[model samples]
Target: MAANDFYKTPSDAVTAVNSIYFLLNAGSNAVQTPYNTLFNTGMNFMGDDENPGPGATNPDVRSQSVLGHASTGLRVLQIWQQHYSGIKKANIAIEKIPGIDFGANTKLRERLIGEAKFLRALYYFNLVRLYGGVPLILKDLSTLEEAHSKPRRNTVQEVYAQIEKDLIEASTVLDPIAGGADAGRATAGAAKALLAKVYLTQRKWENAILKANEVITGPYGYNLVQNYAEVFLPIYKNGPEHIFSAQFKSVSQGQGNNQAPRSVLTGVPGIVGSYADQVVFYSVPDATKPGGVDKFFSVYKLYSKKDKRRDVTFVTKFKSPTNGNWYGRLNDPAIPGDSVPFFNKYWDPANVSNLAESGANVPIIRFSEVLLILAEAENELNGPTGIAYTNINKVRRRAGLDDLTEGLSQHQFRDSLYLERRLEFVFEYQRWFDLIRERDAAGNGILESSLHKVGKTNASAKHYLFPIPQQEIDLNPNLEQNPGWL
Candidate 1:
């Protein structure tokens, strides 16, 4: 059947859009996909909050951890390929689905197209952030000539303009609530929330606040989950707080959440796990240690004991099921000898037999982030107005923390909000983006400074945007590399 002939009915349109979603998280045959452990690990390693564990011996992975990855790096190439693959799938659906005849179900056709637009926007958003500017391929190319003719990278402003256009159109057509089996699909609120984030990234303060406010007050019914831990629980997937999340299920091969296995520590009896990554901790010089080794510092020490989010975010110790003995203490000060904390958000207790069978969904966007966006944008424009304080306090109150000081300058509030984002979203593939986008009072790039604070001195201004993959540039000579990469 011809490609155009296949989309003659609503079922055909649905199937096409479904493939895009599959590529977004779970590629065919258990392959690594965007938002999966392999991709998130690369992002996490680049941030200050995570480090490649001892078991992660991949040179590509280690290169990113030390900010030494080049344009030829495998991790960089994989990220570029997977996201564009998703974009291609999205383009086919967006172009073909509109021609399908839905008869009485016209809304279904529109909804499918909206989903495709939302996904395409998301792919471009990530691409622009990582590569500064990327090829803005919207329509499906019919021939190799068409493909090769338009390989030039668009301007960063042009890419963002397309992202905003897609999200705006998607916001109009998508349902406010994706309920029943459609729980993980993009909703109207999700589109607005993501748009708010895009605006925030561009430093468009008023626009960001407007989009965030639409999500907050719009009939989406999004709110912070009363229990901080319940937000990531598998049973509570697509709960009130989740605006959109990448769906995962453990019943089939290639469908489980791989983040769980990678984050879990190995050598724990009865648990087959690989500690491919762990939370970052500070270190101090110790003269008495052999080889003058530095003592370990626990990242969890930054969290207050009373903060309910601390226990839910990091695992300091766990009881071994095989021997019934606790391996480490809760909140042990890692002076020199203490277990390193692993991420707890994706750890699934039910999938102990095979950590790869964990079914927890990776959140793409949720309500709490929208609140933070509103707070950050409002403060940027209005300087910590009552509206900003109220939204920020909502998250703080949930974490069992006191409100912000009675009066704070815009700088103080901005610093506090950034810290809250680091703590609230650890290991969720957010820290790296925040590190790159955030600016200091002097308007200088902060990625190098932030990495320097965490003992990674290799980061420079060029580290803000990853190099465009060398393989890509080789394939299309017109695809120029980002500055400092060549």
Candidate 2:
């Protein structure tokens, strides 16, 4: 097993493993994570909703961008160093899991090992997916000698191969569903769900469909929540549909990190009472889409009015200010009042208990997405026409959109599904990868052969795979830069 202090003891291994969850946060304008540079950060710079923090010019933000570009800046090195530090810790826990005593309980040992492997795979997958083929170091390479001696990029196939393998192993060990206190932990369904996604990205449509279907139809203890908006309530932590969500606790100053309370950071800027320099931990008001009720209203189709999820998923302007919640547009004059959008989804008027305190969990992998993957892969396997409507309708039904009553050709169905995907799962960090897979080697889809002209779609350029941080390259000459940049 990995010989490291953090790798010693089952408890120590668990603590180290838990730390990896912190890496899952999406929207934090705090100085620590240069939110502006990351596409996932909803607001880039303006701290205002419309404008995220200024781009990479913000040192932390800039460094994050440079990690992909050819720039040999220290910020790039810092991000790389820190990321590996977390990766290394998680890797060590995975390695040591088997060696530790998980007691006579066979399931306990298997579950812990599975948990560690899932975390290890998740951390490495994030790195590999972000920065093409990285040094696939599976152990703690602590010293200068070890760091400098680490090998160059492993093939991208090999990187994904490892991810696929870990997830498969995790599926074997993780509990199917333990419930409540254990819901947030890795589950057999989570591994299967992630494996299906990886397979889809790899274009192994058959496997993706099979795995996704297994999760969708199998006994994983998940189902569609009755009310979509109520689904976001911390009170609904036990919702059957959520396969796995990053858990947070309600402290006076909320405990835990991640997208669970990210809305607070993005939606609620520092108020007169709150300090500007405040590291608003859990929740924030949306500067761009200000009111909890107003933004929810925006989701309504001007004409297609029957969508039940509209009220279920978001609190629209039509809904009256309940006991505590009120609806109003973002009042920011910088962006015209008409243009300013409020975020209605994922807020609790009951949260007036405290703006910062929250217990909301972020759905990292919900069964709904698994259902979508299953439908997508099944349709793709059948050339989109044979069973296309069946696959598309499941997600559409959930989103309050009408199903395609008549069968459409393969190409049309593909576009229909893609649009549904975008609407059903906005701001969930799935779009970028989804587009990447649908596109060709050139980073565009076959029928529509061009990446969406968005921020970082440099498929031709290796910027798609961020650089192996300048410092790491400098230290280990074996490391090679992706094609486009230095």
Candidate 3:
């Protein structure tokens, strides 16, 4: 079954596009996929909101947490490998699908190509952000000679230009909404929403506002779920609020969400779990302190007690099913009790006996984020207008908080929006990106400053872009390493 022969039929075109989604969502195993624990640990461990928990003793994981990961680090290599793998698959589909004649069903052919382009844009988006100037491989390589002649890294601007082009085309061809079995696939709304995020990242305020506004007022009908907690629950998977997500299912060997086990505390008498690899608070028992430990700046502490998002985002206590007794509390003396809060956002209650089998879709873009994007871009372009206030208030109100203080300066408004994004999207893997993108008064990215405030002194300007994997450089002399890595 050659690819050219296999792609001649409509069913084959569908299968070809499906493979791209499969690779993006569920790889060969749980550890290899982007949305799983391993990928998150590699990509986001340096964020102020996350730290390597007691059980995270692997040096590769620790190196990232401390912002000292080298070019040879395993996690860095895996991130590079996984994203390029996805990009290659997308390239194949994008090239082959258009050639297949769908007869009367031209829409299907158009949709498949749209999906491939959207996914390719997303893969390159991740690459360009993390590694900077990755090779813009848009076509499928056919020969061993072509594969051996590795392409040189394109400029970051070039990569972004390609991303914008693909997404613009995708948004036009994709359906406004995906329904029935087509759920979880990319839609026009997702493309527009992601493009808006890219624009916001690039500081193109006007374009960001225009694209985000389209998703908000467009025919997509996306909105925030009534209850904040329901957004991550399996029952609400692909709900109206979710513009796009990496799909997962329970008890499906490699398809389950691995974050459930990675974030859950191990040795719980009643619940099956694993080492809490990433935690909001990293602390230990100290008999000298009142709470038996010196309390540091936990990301959870940033949320006011009145904010509903706090309880939904973290679990301070859990009842043991073994004895029907609650065994955890905030500031509890017992270690692993409630002294440290576990991420509750992705914990699947259905997989109480096997956390690894939990079914939870990892949200890539949600309606709430779009609202915040609108607020941020609007403030940047036009100061805090009524539209900006209204959009930011929508998210704040959902968190059960009052409207933002009136008549704040642009600086004050931007600061507030930054905090709002952090609290709104903890453990969803947005913190690191936000930290790197948002700048401080000094004109430097807040990533280094924010990490330093949290006692991560190793963070520096060089950390803004990760080193290209040494393995990659070894294989291809054309692939140059990022600055400061040498």
RMSD (CA, angstroms), candidate 3: 2.8
- Per-residue lDDT over 256-368 for candidate 3, one digit per residue giving the tens place of the 0 to 100 score: 88777767667667686665455545444567656776564488778998999998888855666687766553454533334567788877888876777778888888999
Model 1, position 37, has a per-residue lDDT of 72
Q: Model 2 over residues 1-486: C-alpha lDDT tens digits?
A: 335554556676566667665444322335232121233331221111112222223454433422223446444454455456656766666666667765666577667778877876776666666667777777766667875575878988998899888899999989888675666788898899888888877778899988987887778867777566656677887578777665655653335232323333232322111211111111224555545323322222321557665444333232232343333344345334432222333444455334344466556677777767766676667866544566667666766777765756555666666666655654444554554456532435532222212222333534345556677767778888776667
Deviating ranges (above 4 Å) for candidate 3: 27-30, 280-294, 329-338
Q: Identify the superior model by TM-score, candidate 2 or candidate 3.
A: 3
Instruction: Identify the superior model by lDDT, candidate 2 or candidate 3.
Output: 3
Q: TM-scores across all candidates?
A: 0.95, 0.76, 0.94
By summed lDDT, which 10 consecutive residues of candidate 3 come out lowest? 329-338
**lDDT for each residue of candidate 1 in 1-486, tens digit (9 for 90 to 100):** 656768787888888888889876784324678777756656778878888887788888888898889999988898889899889889989988877778888998899999999999999999899889999999887676876674799999999999999999999999999999788998899999999999999999999999999999999999999999889989888999999888888768668888787777677787766778876766656576454654455456568889899989987666676888666532345344565777888877788657677888888889999999999999999999999999999999999999988699998999899888888988878888899898877778778888887789878888988999999888889998888997
Model 1 residue 299 distance off true place after TM-score fit, in angstroms: 3.4
Ten consecutive residues with minimal summed lDDT in candidate 2? 271-280
- Candidate 2's displacement at residue 169, Å, is 0.8
Worst 10 residues of 1 by lDDT: 328-337
